[model samples]
Target: MPLRSIQSAIYTTTMNHSLLFTRFTVSLILCFIASAAVAAVAADKPNILIVFTDDQGYADLACYGNEANKTPRLDQLAAEGTRFTSFYSQTVCGPSRSALLTGRQPLRSKGWGMPASEITFAELIRNAGYQTACIGKWDVSNRKAILDRMPNAQGFDYYFGTLGANDGGRVRFHENNEPAGATDDMGSLTTLYTDKAIEYLNEKRDPEKPFVLYLAHTMMHTIIDASDRFRGKSAGGLYGDVVEEFDHETGRLLDVVDDLGLSENTLVIYTSDNGPWNQPKYTDRKKGHPEGSIFWGQSGPLRNGKGSCYEGGYRLPCIVRWPGKVPAGRVSDALFATIDFMPTFAHLAGFDVPRDRRIDGIDQTDLLLGKRDTGREHFYFNNAGVRQGDWKYLKPDAYFHGYAIEADRKKVDELYNLKSDLGEQTNLAAEHPEKVAELKALMRQIEGNDPPGTSPIQIK
Candidate 1:
């Protein structure tokens, strides 16, 4: 039997082993290349930046109909993208932010901040591999127990802003769950928030990942202030001065995006939580408000201002700019809401909307992309106890702001045709009872038989 046969077998075995090792190495290299390509594609996904203003009225922006307060940058934003005529948010900040984040009605979520059970847009986008940040006034909750209820816990990777309103001189600014400091001077707030947002984009953001930056501003609301640079800048007085500075800061933020060559790939959205805060003092005030006098923001032709269930309260001023994606200089009458943003962003990021919970927001991706002209046939006004379209029906003795209906009007429903009567001067309830019934049915369906009620009369 022989040494020759054993040597041949050993040589064949060694050759086979070498061939298998070479194949395995080649396979590993191909897998690494494929994984890198996938990451690159994910990084190139469009960036979403929502610049939400505080208590800005529907007609506050110059392009929105204000000729007194100059908003060149915001006007330019409208010129560069589609301006929505019928965008909505809740009547107040807390509910509005919750609705925007979770795609559910604020009442549907937990008491104040977003419920732990709900899935946030941040979490969804992050799951799809995007960086998330909330960099402004976050009024979702006043509670401090649950860190998970905060932005850091909800979904945002970074949180740097005030927990609640900037009024009362007791506002505490927090950064990622820790108290950063007390925000004494409200005048420089817009600039500070903008700087932080830019820092996140330039320094904190990962170059290999797409990001969502929610820049919620703290301006135009009550107890307002403006930096010295913007103090005497507008003809509309103190209110006008604050608005102008907000516009300037917005322009600065946009400039950063363009300088970074990310304009085309970034989606910039500018809007407000609700309408203007027009109280007793602000009604008779002129453009140049006197010293020590409070100035409530204007709502142009809309009836009433913030905290009321009227059009001026919930119908927010909205501007969306996405360079080539959204058509420039296009004005749309599409009905949209802040709640819609969660689903819309998820759609754009190629992520699935959470199916485990009830999401009130409808997908408005087609409307934003200019593939459609209309969206959301019916929009429920949470504060109003009414549903709007062409016809708006107010429940019997529905209380708006602090004014209740007189005895004669208490038993009767109030109806207004928003299309023909934007100011809501006429009550066509008796004339259009059928339309009243239709809207009432819708109100009950959406709000679950909750009779028309007020929200403790928020002044300013």
Candidate 2:
């Protein structure tokens, strides 16, 4: 046992300790990566952002193949989430908003057709502890006398923008109902909605609570108003420039989410209330620059334009992005209605449907998660209409000049195999008489035909 032996023993011990420490550190790193992957996989809850536009078409988005229109931000959003091919909103403003709120068809609620009855997504989400905010257009039950049935009564903590359609329609705004100075000599309504929303995020957000922002855009469906910044920006027309401006403002919201570190946990939804305004004719006041386009905003082989009971009136463009969940850049052809929004939002927020409350929307949470197929195979449309898979059934007399005309004479009346005749040009009622009877029976059954206030349908 000499000094050299002692030195050799001491060196071997130190080297062994170093090797052991290295292995432990590597193992810890691997565990951290595995944990992160699991968290990504299991992160189901999301901050909901329902981005609703005024009168965009079912086929108006670049992602939806509206080659004429360019929506780079929305396109990028689509690339990161799910795009629904056959989403729906009402042909007009109020009813679509109503159906989305109550989870029931507009016809079923008091403000069913207009706005002033009861219930809303804001109320429900707020009950579930979400910070609910409605931007752009309220368009329904916002009047002071209608408090019991208004957005605040229904559950929104923050509200902004016009309470109705165009500022020309029923001008109003609220910073949580406290009106602020217009940001620009006229900022676009789109910019104001986004700016106020960002301010809410900056000042009121707790970082721990999930938020539900209902952005009801007043652009592209207005007095065709635009800020000085975007007065003339696109090739489509002034309306096209306005739409481009709308798209740019959307980019700002996206940036805010990224900057605020909310992107990963937020579910941003983009859609329109319905398709274009019946391509309004141009007069001086009607300058008609923003009346949407039959020339540019295509319904992609769908029958008819807005205001008609055809696909254009109700069918809409829908895109959803939840960073860590939902398949990215995928298109979904799932049949969803305005009525379904409430239930979907509730489920995403982890709230339960009240048993006493007659919730009409089926909880398609599995569909939203991309765990199920898109062909929902079931849904009821506005104006006593019904669509089950490829066969869309109108009540033979279900025309709605405004939105809910009880007796529509030139109604398509029969059913069309949507897969074979999506344009709905043919009448299959005679050949498939049995199918007609079946669908007609369902329409009456689901509607329950209070049969007192409106149209009557006692078949022969």
Candidate 3:
């Protein structure tokens, strides 16, 4: 009860409290370190970024042998990744997007508007705990009732971009199903999408979770629009300007990934939905309509562009960059398609492919990693024909050359060895009638296997 006893009790209490606080602080630091380590380990699973451009041709970039449109960033991307010499996508926007998202031919899935019943790559990756985002042109379907068929309902955690192409005065834009704005000014669309993507990498995405960012650019399609910063920047006219702007925005996105230290772990792929819309059909070009020539994109040495079943229509330019995993500056003439991305990504991310439905995509993990050279052996191009090995058989009236050919003109089955005839100029169908029959039989087999509800295989 004396002063000395009271002081001794206070000292004891203070020392006890100090020891307890010190212990708590040390435990907190340890827990923080352990959490950081766990996140780092999870990051090893790698993130995915798909830079898909609409209507971009195989020869659109510098690395693809284009002399005019100088896409330094994309050229560098090709240099840092594996560039595919022969890649395929659907002949149109909606089908191509559907194929990439679902890993099944549009016919195999439910055609244009990706059916709600089909699974998507985003859904597959999401099941593995990854953050999935789709930013830019999502032209799967823009119809009101099928609006849910857009990226958000399909599986994207966040969706920002247009529902269709930016070819008209007004492009429908949305931010996760809700309307963002309908803008006639297409100049800023690329910047908006790219900035949003960078923001996702920098802020929106959970740092501990791997992410799938599909940035589908709207430029390089019809009525090409470029930002003011890229006007008159190249020798290829307005089309060049638009492509260069896309390249710049792509560089900005890559820079952000590097800044965030995600470059090493991110699998970045740059490709197109289909070949360029070089010859847009105009039954009558009245006053204000967009001139196809002003925004024409080249398909290089290939015979015809867009809308055609020829080499130019669906043969795409694909670049895959994964730092040490994918070989740098490697050019592969292997056969791969947009439909293969779902299974390939699922394979790389250690996820399971949807077992309930039939997926047409084959895993190309080994092919992309440079362990092998070939990917796909047979690819069916909508109405074109079946391309197995080097043989391609065209249907009697399958080739649709946009505005170049008369719609009612009659044609015959044509076959070509793609390995020797990349341009498809020399038709050997008459010479090798047996080969043509084989391709026709394969086409018939594929059609017979088509899931119910698919439109009858349209050969004409």
Best by lDDT: 3
- Highest-scoring model, TM-score: 3
lDDT of all the models against the reference? 0.80, 0.68, 0.81
Which pairs clash in model 3?
A: none
- lDDT by residue (tens digit), candidate 1, 20-117: 99899899999898879876776557899999999888888899898898999999999999999988887777888888888777767643556676
Taking all chains together, the TM-score of candidate 3 against the true structure is 0.88
Q: Write the per-residue lDDT of candidate 3 for residues 1-460, one digit (tens) a residue.
A: 9999999999999999999999999999999998998686566677999999988888989889999888999999999999998899887788888889988877766556667777888987888878999998887774442655878788899988887875565687788878887787777888988999988888899987888999998877766677789877778887888888999999999998998898999999999988776663642442233454376677998766777788888898999999999999999988888988887888777788776666777888899889988778788888668888888888986846456454544598889888888888888988999999888988877666655423222210
Residue by residue across 232-278, what tens digits does model 2's lDDT show? 66666656666777788888988998998888888888888777754
Candidate 2: residue pairs that collide: 123-154, 123-155, 139-163, 390-418, 396-413, 397-408, 399-408
Worst 10 contiguous positions by lDDT, candidate 3:
451-460
| Candidate 1 residue runs with Cα over 4 Å from true position | 1-36, 110-113, 143-145, 281-290, 403-411, 449-460
